[model samples]
Target: MTSSAGFTASLGRRRAYWQAGVCLAVLLGAVYLARSHWPALESGAGRLAVADQGWLLTGAVAAAGTWAASALAQQGAVVRRLPGARLTATQFAASAANHLLPAGLGAGAVNLRFLMRCGLPPGRAAGALAVKAASGAVVRLALLALLAPVCPGLLRLPRVSPLVVAAVLTAAGLAAVLLATPWWTRCRRALAAVLADIRALHARPARAAALWGGSVAFAALHALVLIAVTRAVGLPLAPLQVALLYLAASSAAALLPTPGGLGSLDAALAFALTAAGTPGAGAASAVLGYRLLTVWLPLLPGLLVLAVLVRRKAL
Candidate 1:
């Protein structure tokens, strides 16, 4: 029995290795396909390099702030149930996994696992994750709503009409309702029963406020990062226009199931940049640079964190 169990474990490890190898191959192939537009990316990078160093610094700060805000939001979601869980560590691991693992689901899974490992009940963990997801959706929707009125100018190059904008917003609203209603219905009785339990351990309202505010700030900063890259590469789009395009493309990419939305994000951003009036070459460069900061930069740290967690038997 012991030998059979060992063999089974070995086979499982080998299968995991094979799967990882396949994922890596797919990722490389996608990057190669993306590289066909390298000329544009090069020009954009050159343009950005020629810009004032201030823009680069500002972009870095903005990116960092965005991550910090997101960490706080995650921390707030679980605070009520897992009071003893280390929020900072949880955020780091979760964010790292979100970026490094294939499919965005990895981060959420890691978060739930972490909470469970720390002794939180499954129901509470699920509830916290649901709340966190809902809060994030609310923040994104609010930003989209705020930006909806001015979308005409942003979509001017693409000639996206006001009717289209309205339709998109209406769809988003419907989707949100659909997603929430079923969950609410299923959990209604449980929620009612646990109301006192939940209320007794309420998360800090101030933390929640900060989390939402920070989410908006992070979204704004993300746009600014792209704008800075555009300036660096000498692309000609206004800040607001760039922000609107960024938001639209990013929101669309989030729907994709690819690891970190890899290929989808690049393609979407490039298209959005073109729609915002940038030439193909410049748009490609901005996308590459943005990926550099957002994806590649975090990869090393993510791997390091994963290694540490594994060593500690925490992953």
Candidate 2:
């Protein structure tokens, strides 16, 4: 009895530490945004104030739909049906958690825990995440291919400088060194498990359709959010053109490891908007509007949901 009590206490302490870390990250992220990007944020909010309310409402609806799309994709990753309401709620919470840490770590940990709690083995839960990620990437790529033709010369490949080449080479060498170790063996096994799950999911036609369809809809809805924001702010770009720019900008931003692609995405998106004939200030305002709907506005409620889920042992 004493041992059990001690174990429970230890677990409680770990949870406390994790919660503290999340709080710290949120505080730091807020500070950074205020300190570094206050001007843009303020300007954008002011513009959004006068912007079209109807279009802003459209953007909000699209943003909300993304959670449902994510829930669908997540369910498609596993054979077992996750409770629909909980899954959607988890996606909202995960988005909130996603902004607290860099490179998707916060969201990944949250989803992994939720999956395990839903009765998946650790390996299977991890594989399900992998499947979801892979499908999202593939869907993004396919959409990019289909949309690229609409705006020719809009996305020219940047000249690869020697520095970029050198970085790639260095990364490859490091990856090679890592691959020589026991870690590589574990990674290989993990890859195999993920592949098996992928095969299992694809074997079921409904699951396969959900996986791909949800992924496509998720990306499209996100682009729609940005496009709607641009319209709200009266950016000159047409909706299709804006959508293409968003896909390109987001794809490039994905290469950078930021919390919710905060800095990287903001920069890339602003640049893309400006290059597409928007004034610099207008681009900044549009990006700010997009962030408002997707991140800042939803953040508090998401964190509250996360806390409630933790209390309920949902994650």
How well does candidate 1 match the true structure in TM-score terms? 0.71
Q: All models: lDDT?
A: 0.69, 0.87
TM-scores for the candidates? 0.71, 0.86
lDDT of 1: 0.69
How far in Å is the alpha carbon of 138 misplaced in model 2?
1.0
Q: Write model 1 residue lDDT over 51-131, tens digit each, in one string.
A: 656766666666656666666665566554343334445555666677656555677777787767777788777666665
Q: For model 2, what is the alpha-carbon lDDT of residue 268?
A: 83
Task: For model 1, name the residue pairs that clash.
Answer: 40-281, 41-285, 47-232, 48-232, 48-233, 103-259
In TM-score terms, which candidate is top?
Answer: 2
Report the C-alpha displacement of residue 251, candidate 2, in angstroms.
1.7
